[model samples]
Target: MSRHDYFSQFLHAVWHGESGHPLVASLLAQPAFAVYRNTIFKGCVDALSANYPAVRRLVGEQWFQGAALAYARRHMPDDACLIAYGDGFPDFLDSVDAVRELPYLPGVARLDRYWSESHLAADDAPLDTAGLHAVLASGRDVQLAPQAATRWHWEPAYPGYSIWNANRDPGAGPLSGLEWHGEGALLTRPEGQVQWQPIGLGACRFLDACRAGMGVAAAAGLAQAAEPGLDVAVMLGELVQAGAFTSFH
Candidate 1:
């Protein structure tokens, strides 16, 4: 093998704790290699920990660090930059046995991922009230803002949104008895800060329809069908105020 190939193989073995490579003796003699390995592993651990603060908070520091390190070893970052490194960590959390009792952990991770994604999304101007009115006047289709993210997964099974919101603020005392219901989350970065609000099933469906390029009236119809007593106008007003749409055509 070429010198470069030999060096690469040596480093790979050191990383995975395999000491059988031909250059293992040489690498073992260098103390810096061990330091480099530990630093890389710790960096990955810290990145994943930051991305899933809610999960870390739910499952104490020691538990989180152990899990994070294992996860890093299994799934190294695909990119050089580690800012959005834990994109697949929610699924990883689901596969582990340690958190089997905490069924909401995966969903909390997913929500945290969404918050990071929205914060990194490209900046776009939200549609103003006049623009919204003009589109409604023209009776055309509407599209959701690039930053807007909506989900309808937290139902009777697990209160994902409630759990996340309660723990998002470190100082927000212990969560009281959860008001179990079909709660959804709508997230968007309006003024450089990612903000998420609890929404209803009808609102989520409406937003989904809008995402699919449905006209205002059709989307409203879908929302009303999902919830017979839904007030389309009111929901639209709330979404508009929340900066949910970029523009309507």
Candidate 2:
């Protein structure tokens, strides 16, 4: 086999815990190769731990590491950038037997993923009140684009945002007296740091409409339709202030 093909086979064998490959059979039998394989697994577990700190904090280190190892075995990083890894972690959590009792775990994982994505998103200036007014004054049909770092999620059944926000920090105190209800989370990187807040269903729908390339008026109407008596103007103002929009066209 070519050198490149040989190396690929070796890597596949080592990474997937397989020793049957003829090219890697001797290497897999070596003690040093076992150490190297373990190191690779550890690195993947570490990357997953860093990517899903909230999940790690929610579950203890021992449990999280075990889950991470299992997840790493089934799913390898697609690219060299480990920071962008674990995109399917939330879905993996959903299928885990241990996670069956914690239905909200997947949602929390998704929020953590969103936070990582926001942190890695490209820099862009968010729309300010003046820019919003200018767009309104133009009296032309335009669809507002969410900022590059803007990410929002709404869970219709679980208070995942509340759980995630409470456990996001290692030093955060124990959660108590939390009301079990649907919650929405909105994240934005207005400046350099990522910021997040609990949002309402109306706000979530509005952002969804904006993401779907609907005009401002149409987005507002969708929000109102989702939630009657919702103050679309107020919601719009709050979103603008939160730096959720990047531009309109």
* TM-score of model number 1: 0.86
lDDT of model 1, residue 42: 94
What C-alpha lDDT do the candidate models reach, one value each? 0.77, 0.88
Model 1: CA > 4 A from native: 2-11, 19-21, 24-31, 148-156
| Cα lDDT of model 2 by residue, 145-198, tens digit | 999999999998999888998889656577889889999999998778899998
Q: For model 2, which pairs clash?
A: none
Best by lDDT: 2
Residue 60 of model 2, lDDT score: 90
